[model samples]
Target: MANARNLSTSSEPLNPKTFLSSIFDAAVAAADAKLTIRGHLPQKPKGRTVVVGAGKGAAQMAVAFEKAWDGPIDGLVITRYGYSAPTERIEIVESAHPVPDEAGLMGSRRLLEKVAGLTDDDLVVALICGGGSALLPSPAPGISLADEIAVNQALLASGAPIAAMNTIRKHISTIKGGRLAAVAWPAKVVSLVVSDIPGDNLALVASGPTVPDTGSRADALAAIAAYGMKFPDAVMAHINSRAATAPDPADEKFARNEVYLIASASVSLEAAAADSRRQGIEAVILSDALEGEAREVGSVHAAIAREVATRNRPFTKPVLILSGGETTVTLRAKGKGGRNSEFLLAFAIGIDGLNGINALAADTDGIDGSESNAGAFCDGSTVARMRAVGVDAKAMLAGNNAWTAFKAVGDLFVTGPTGTNVNDLRAILVR
Candidate 1:
């Protein structure tokens, strides 16, 4: 990683909007594949060096790898629609994310076939990141892509954490759970991973196509039962069977593989903090791996900010409180809000009339949930502004419709397809 420069030390006053937005941008840029992929590249092999990956950022990872490698390289990667990048040797295939599609099925089949019959001298560079699980949907034998889609839908709506969801995904998929690595056999597979999992678990990022699996079909079944996720009878039988199990971690095929976490929410949070300090404000990183229900997490954060605003107890006044992680939203209604928007909605209502408190919550990947906006911004007057537009802020949150409320109040943060994913970056500036 490169050094974080002190951007400014002047005595000028900070603009809350501009400063908070910069903190977000700094967090996202810190995890960009262009900056994070250079040093992590493996030593070129004497034989072929093929790249295969799938994620929202896989296209950009391919571009960076091409620029960094001196030897010839060619392969394929699957990225979400509208997140594709131009590359000469590597083919960038656009696919659906958070849900697999026909394009992903075809692309995933091509990706799996790219590494066939590799020798010991050949290298398989796997550029893994967030959203790879849904972007590459090569279903297991005797299962249809529709079956996998049903599983993904249930997992998403079940509000399972990345691990639980991916546990299920790995057990039923063809390319995931290190099966891709197993296929390469004698070839050394070095994975350059940009982690989006809260705890930096490489195996769960995009279901870890190139990494080993420590989970099994039994875990997936337990997750399904715990969440009360109903599936087709055929699907249930498939999970109950042993054939759905992933390759064992002790399998010799993984002996030569390497995994590197080049970028993550922790590093980005520190980068945001460094940028905050350079702008003459104290930045406190609350945590990098917080996990809970979305609105509940927002309420707790709002309480902290309120306490800071009223009484300077924790760390004194004028502090930028930062956090990063994957927060889940258990769906009770078919609402239009993602986890970040839901978090901001609850937070806005909690600190409705408080002054000098402004915050921005956004996914670093430039998409919050399935919404077009990255996230929504909130401040002391956010609820009041929503009322001005006749939006009942609390009711919106109750209905899980924070995205609509944010849009109605004109505070939706927009940064389309940032070519990276490090999960969510949230900043609360208390003045």
Candidate 2:
């Protein structure tokens, strides 16, 4: 249990902003590849050691493995553009994220080719994390990169949960949902996963590239229907065609594969909570697997914070409320912001300038949605400050323009690529 006070050795007194930032830093530190990856590393294989992975943290995980392992390793991994870390042995390739691209498709093909004809003695180390589903795109035989992109876009805008999105992704791909692991049949596969999804479902994280998939084509269709998504014809045909089925979990080929959760949102939240307690604040972790719309979740959290502040019904004052999970944002308005920003905006609205309440919400990956900022911060004065500047907070919230609102208030959190992904971390400090 690392103390929050040790996060910064400076002599300055820790204020609300500094304390919140320290809490977030503790969360990110807990999920850092260099800190967590070495502990989960498998023994050096007797035969050829191949490293294949994809995600925002894939490259960093590779670097960590390279530093910890003494054996010679070679392979390739695809990561989001700008999220790539320097690695000497394992090749790193940059590709588009949140949407699949030709680069990702080509990389997935190359990875499959690399694993072909592997003997039972060989080892395949897969570095998996969030954003891998899009970073390692391998469209089905009938689907094109453009078709995959369209379906991803629709799914993202539909506010569908990550599990639902991954179910559909597995059904229309060549390498997802245990298909990657299937290609390396008979070879020992040890996947080191940094989970970003709520519940840490091994099958859902990054679409479970190296684990057994229990979902079926019917599940994909049900998700599409439930979300009212209008996917492209090619995507629909691929799912409806005979090639829709994923690799069966009962297959003996998967008997040698192992999936290890190196880090997760729950661990990160616990780290934050420990630090808050060290700072003499009563920390209450509402939930680490919270899901639903970002705004609604923020509103509910705000209500809880208010109750603690006004009546102390649930807890005493000077309490820090913490949570971790992935929240969705339905694109109702054409605005530039991610779920974290939207959550902060709604929280600000719900608090309504009530004194003695301050909060911070940010994605652990240091990128909130598609925005440049990780997320945003809001205090009791956030609403008042925006109103003083002639900015209507409610109007901005309605337009889904939380980015603009936070930017105007100079509250946008901008920590460039934390080199890790564990989902989102949020904290509300009520005094």
Candidate 3:
């Protein structure tokens, strides 16, 4: 964790919105790949040094690597369409995210070609971040791109855990599950990753494009059946026919590969906690790896906040309860909202009419689920404000219309794009 610093505040009372926002900001600033990659650079190689990357932060990671290294770097990186950064030697290719597209397929093919014929004297630096799976959707030999897209759609709505989803993604993918590292076989590979997966499992992040994978096609099928995910014949055909083809742990190809955890949710949460401490507020970090239904998680947080407020059993008043991790939301209704909105809205309802409680939840990527807003803010009066605006908080949540509910109350938090992804950061302040 970084050093803690006090937040500048006037003599007046605490501003919940501003306080929560500052905490969130500190968390995001800690995960910046451009800053984090400086301490983890590899030595200059004898032959050519190629950089291959993918995810929302891939473009920025490439730019940072280009600036730090003292050699000629030429390679391509795929990122979400709007999440590109300026780079001199490295080429950036914008593609789709949360779902694969034609552009991702073409860029994936090009990336494989760039690292295919590397020599033992060369170096391959893999810049991987959260959204690499959808950004590098190069399907296996017999599977079509359409098949991959179909599976992606199911996985997004399946309400399954991220590990299960990435396992399925890796099995059907040609560029994931250490296949990328295998392609650069004899050449040394170093991966600098901004992890979104809980527990900082590099093998599951972006489906382990440059790391060994222990998951198999059988695991994917089990997840599909467990989640009741339905896909078309083509997708099912690839899933059923494919065996466990991902690179094994003892593969000689990955013997020289190196992986670094550049940034992660746990580190970000601790950073936020430290900031809160320096700001004259007690901070309690519940967990950095909490994962479950979004609304349910919100409700649980509300319960904890209520306990702290009513009794102060675990913590005293004026404390900030923090948690970080990627949460899932099942598509219950055809309403417009994301996981963060659902979380905050559920929290609003649970803490309705209760005073001295406020909270904020947001995805580090600046986008929550498929919605435009990064997240929404909720205080004790949030539900009252929604009721005054003719929005039933519970109904809105059930309909997956938390975005609209929060919009009516003017609490939506939009941060455009942070160019980094470490999953979600949530805070509850009780004063």
**lDDT per residue (tens digit) for residues 1-431 in model 3:** 24533333346667789889998899999998778998999988999899999998888888888888877889989998888989899999999888889999999999899999889999999999999999998887677888889889888887898999999888788889999889998999999999999888998888888987788778888999999999777667777883546779688888888999999998899999888888878898999888999999999999999999999968888799999888888888888888889999999988998999989999998988777788989999998898998999999999988999999999998887888899999999998
Q: Residues 3-73, candidate 1: write the lDDT tens digits.
A: 53333444565577788889998898899888989988798898999999989998999999999888899
Best by lDDT: 1
RMSD to true structure for each model, in Å: 2.4, 2.3, 2.1
Question: What does candidate 2's lDDT look like per residue over 1-431, in tens digits?
Answer: 35344322336544888889988998999999899988888877779999999888899999998998889899999899899888999999989988888899899999999898999989999999999999988888888888889988998999999999999999988899998899998899999999999999978888988886788889999989998999988899889987888989889999878889999999999999888878767688888889999999989988998898789869787788999888998888998899999999999998985898889999998899887889999988898899988889889888888999999889999998898999999999887
TM-score per prediction, in order, is 0.96, 0.96, 0.96
Clashing pairs in 1: none
What is residue 382's positional error in candidate 1, in angstroms? Answer: 0.9
lDDT of each: 0.90, 0.89, 0.88
lDDT: the better of candidates 2 and 3: 2
